[model samples]
Target chain A: MIEVEGVERRYDGVAVLSEVTLSLPKGGLTAIIGPNGAGKSTLLSVMGRLQKPDAGRVTLEGMHLAQAPGRAVAKKLAMLRQDNHTAARLTVRDLVAFGRYPHCRGNPGPEDQAQIDRALAILGLEPLADRFLDQLSGGQRQRAHIAMVLAQDTGCILLDEPLNNLDISHAVRIITLVREAAQALGKTVVVVLHDINMAAAHCDRIVVMKGGRILRHGTPAELMQADFLSAVYETPISVHELAGRLVAVY
Target chain B: MSPEIRARQITHRMALLALLALLAAAAFLLLNARGSWDFLLPFRGRKLAALAVVAVAIALSTVVFQTVTQNRILTPAIMGFDALYVLIQTGLVFGLGAGRVSALDARLVFGLELGAMVVFALLLFRWMFGPAARNLHLLMLVGIVLGTLFRSIAGFLQRIIDPDSFTVLQDRLFASFNAVDPGLLTLSALIVAGLALILWRLVPELDVLALGREAAVGLGVPQERLVLGLLVIVTLLVALSTALVGPVTFLGLLVANLAYLLLPTGRHAVLLPAAALIALITLIGGQALLERVLHYDTALAVVVEFAGGLVFILLVIRGVAR
Candidate 1:
């Protein structure tokens, strides 16, 4: 389990995340939904240890994340940020191979190579494995990054807006793959998402954040209501039942 | 672009670079062999060794510095390293008096300058690369400002000093490849060898570091500590080369970018050696041409800097720096 306790993060004098606290158990896909500037990404980064919290502490399975050894934390958890800019010109295979750094420390053995191959195959990137990242489309680049995270093979994965720049089919494929990882591999996956319908359709739980605070968090059936979303988003949003699944429209 | 093919390409490129570097070294040492072997070997060999040391130092330091800073166009010289060298020289003349400074052992003076530079670089990096000030643009702005300030202060000290002291200062400041200190050359070779060992252990992490701070941290690198160590190595190298041949501002930028262009991979193991060889070829090859072909009409540093400046502009115009 991951626990965030009274965490506060500020930028300049403004509070980006104020007194945010949450608990995530060991398995399942949890989707965090919020508007722009709602601090969803900030929260995810804090949990991933990419950014330090101004106050409070975060822990994974009784170990304080900030104080734990980096490799230990990396082996247990992995993160993928929104912007994936790199100065080095790396091929898809090269980028994915880096995910095994915590495992092999730059010298990949046969097992590490097998893991790399598996990651590439799962992401459908085998054909583009040797192609430079700059030669790929935005959606393909996004997939390459995702493949790197998957290659990490951690117990927990934190993805901040992973669906960005992805087309509908690819996005669905990724979400489904993520769900499979959560259900089959029993890994805890946390994703900050923008599309509410996608979140309702796939995620086991929903965390609704607004103005740097969690407005509500529960199963889809509990939180997917017209008035609750309308107030949370400050816009008229209607949640309708399409067939047997809930579909959100605004 | 299969993996096998890509690996072969890198190996072939490395072999080609090694061959060119060897050719340049041969041309430098054997182009005009009029003297006896005993006289020519030690005499020309000292200069060649000095050039090779400076080339390796500049190449490794600049490539590592760019990897850590994640900026292609910035070099240690542009960040005020040589300016600080001038500042220290001027301060010594102004404080201890020119007679005392020149009377001091040359090795002692080199040690003092190198120690002060490393200390100052550490402090600057700590201040500018703090958690809140991690923006590359901001760091570049600070470096430029600090560089100008150092130059201005050095200029002020130079103006106030007596004519005799000013002359002494000029001798120290004028960096010529034609006159490298033999004693300093030996010390520099030892230092570069030691730093290369440390850098060798860091090559793997360096490739990951090129991915940026956030990504590196996410991938389990101790970002702050590693960056400080890399900065220390960079400071030592820039100081060593500057103390030996003064400073070649754009040589690092020119050669480092060239290595990146020549090599297909971002692996520092390959990139580091490639940059060093390219620097070696540029310095020795240019020196040989200036002496043999050009008949010593111009300093090699001047011609190299001019070419480097043009490359800098071309890189900017090509929009590759970002």
Candidate 2:
């Protein structure tokens, strides 16, 4: 479980997240949905200990994030940010292999290699594994990055805007992969998504944020209400049940 | 092209290039070797050793500096290390006349210069790493300002100094591989070797770090501590080279970029040695040409600066400045 209490983040004297307190349960897919400047990425970064909160604390599985050794936290949690610019020329396989760094510290044994292979297979990246990341398509590169994060084998995985450069098909495929990883492997998955319909269709829980504050949090069936989303997004959003699944129409 | 085939080609080319560099360096050493076998061997041997040491220092420092800064065109020189070194040399002569400066122990002067460089680096990094003004351009601006300050101070001191003293200082400032100090060569070699060993141990981390700060941190690298340590290493390397044969700013830039182009792999393990070899070849080969073909008419620095500046401009045109 990841717990954030009284978390606040300010940039240039303007508050991005103010007194935001939330507890994310273990072993499920939680999609954070928000409009622009909603602090969704900031919250995820704080939870992953990538950014420090100004006035609060975060605890991951009874270990305080601020106090825990970075290696220890990294072994239990992995984060993938939106922008992944690397100066080094790394192949997909090499990038995925770096996920085992916290575990093997660059000296990978057979088990680590096996995990890397499994991640590649899961992402359907076996063919592209040896290809350089820059040589691959944007969607393929996104999948490779996801594979790397998955190869970390952390119980808690946080992805910020993982679908940014992905097409609809690749986006759905990634959403499915996240859902399956959470359900089958019993891992906690928190992803910041921009598409409301995808969040409604795939997420177990929906977290709605507007202007850096959580407006509503509930199962998709409850949080996908027209009025709730409309208020949160500051636009007209109609939620309808189609094919036994809640879909949002803007 | 298939990645496997590409990798093989790159590796093969890198190997060929490295071998060629070694041969070139060897030929330079042999051609320059003169006088009796005993006297010529050790005398040229010392110069050869100094050239190799300074080459490795400049190459390693430039590569690592580019890695941390995430900019291929930027070298340790941009951080004002070479300027600071000049300032120190000038200050030494200005404060304590040429006689006293020459009387000072060589090792002590080298230590003082190195210490000042490290402290300057630490302070610059600490300021840049702060939350406010986290921009790379801001750091670059600060570095440029600091370099200008050092240069102005040295110039002011030069203006007030005696003409004879100025001549001595000018000789010190001019980078000449032919006149390397044999007395300080042994100590510099040991220091450079020790630094290389420590850097070799950090090869894996350095590889990860080349992925940029956020990515490396997300991958669980101790970013702050590792960055500080790497900066110190960079400072030491730059200082050693600068103290040994004054500042050869563009040589490092040229060698490191050439290494990257030749190796075709971002892996530091290959990149480091490739840069070192390129440096060795350039220094030795350039010196040999200056002595043999050019008939020692012009300084090696002029050729290096010209070639390196052209490469730097080309890199910028290619949009690798970022």
Candidate 3:
């Protein structure tokens, strides 16, 4: 399980994540849905060890993340952040191969290559494997980054807005892959999602954050009430039941 | 595509280029001399060694700096290292009399200057690049302000110093093809070789760092410690090169970009050597042209800067940088 307790992160004396505490059991897809500035991304960043909390502690399976070795945290939890920029011109394959860094350090063996190939195949990036990242379209680039994270093959994956710049087709493909990562591979997937309906439809659990605080956390059916979501979002959100799944409409 | 195959191709091309650049630098050094071969050989040989030292220092530091900062257009000069160097030289002359400055042991003074530079950089940056430091732009801004301040102080000191002292200071302030110290060359080579060995172990991490800070951290590269180590090395390198031959502001920018354009792979293993070779080629070739063609009408630095400035403008306009 991944746990965050009293995690507070501040920037310039303003708290971005204010004493937030949450826990995620192993082998589940938990989508954190929040409006802008709700601290969802900040929370994920803290848990992933991309940034440390000003106060509070985060742990994975009873191991203190901050105290653990860098490679240890990396192996247990992988994070793919939004701003994926590269100074060097790297091909898709090279980028994915880097995902295996924590596993092989720098020296790669056949196992690392196999993992990279699996990630590429799962993302339908085999054809674009040779292309430079700059040569790819926006959607293709998004998929390439996602492939890199998946190639990491960690027990828990934390992605912040992984669907950015992707079209509906690619978006749906990625959502499906994320679901498989949880169900088939039994990896804990905590994704900061923007689209509430997608979160309700696909995720096993939903966390609603507002004003740097968790407003609600429950199963989709439990938290998908129209009035609760509307207050959490401050925009009128209508919730409906469709095909035995809760659909959030805004 | 098989990245291994692509890397192999780039390595092969870089190897060929490296061979050509070495031969060209050698030929430029060994070619015609009007005086005795024995005297001329050593004379040109010292200059060659000086150029090699400066070349390796600038090329290696710029590449590593760019990797850590993830900014291709930025060189060590931008960090105010050379400006600090000028400040140290000016202050030395201003404090100790010009007669004393010239009388001091050159090697000892060079070592002191290098030490002061490295320490200044460490003190300036260590507190700023702390764990909470998120913005690299902050570092650049501080660098710009510090560089200007150092230059201003140096300028003020120069104006007050005696003319003879100013003349003595000028030798330290400007890069001179005719003025590399033979005593320092052997020491500089050993340092560069030592740094090369240390940097070799860092090659893989260097490539990962080019992916930006968060990515590097996520890859378990110990980003902060690694960056600090690299910054110290970069400072030492800039300090050595600037103190050894004065500063060549644009040579690093030119060589690094040329390496990026010429080498196919992003691996630092290939990029660093390729850039160093390219630097050697440019320095040696430009010196050869300055001597044989222009007849020393102007400083080689001026000509190289003019070309490098053009390349810089072209690169910015093309918007190919990160």
Candidate No. with top lDDT: 1
Arrange candidates, best lDDT first: 1, 3, 2
**Model 3 residue pairs with clashes:** none
Candidate number that wins on lDDT, 1 or 2? 1
Report fnat, model 2. 0.67
TM-score of 2: 0.94
Instruction: Report the lDDT of model 2 for residue B72.
Output: 92
In the order shown, the candidates' DockQ scores are: 0.85, 0.65, 0.64
Residue-wise lDDT of candidate 1 within A1-250, one digit each (tens)?
8999999999997999999999989999999998899999999999999999999889999999999988889898999899998879999999999999988888889989999999999989999999999999999999999999999999999999899999988899999999999999999999999999999999999999999998888999999999999988899998899989998888
What TM-score does chain A reach in every model?
Answer: 0.99, 0.98, 0.97
* Stretches of candidate 2 exceeding 4 Å from the true structure: B1-7, B131-133, B306-322
Off by over 4 Å in 1: B93-100, B160-168, B306-322
TM-score of chain B of each: 0.90, 0.91, 0.91
- Report the Cα RMSD per candidate: 2.4, 2.6, 2.4
Local accuracy by lDDT, each model: 0.89, 0.86, 0.86
lDDT of 3 by residue, B1-322 (tens): 4768877878787788778677867776776667888888888888888888888888999999888888888987887887888888899899998888888998888889888888888986686676656477888898899999999999999999989889888866778767767778889889988998899888888888889888887877888889989988988888988888887898998999888877766788889999898888788778877786788898889878876667667866766564
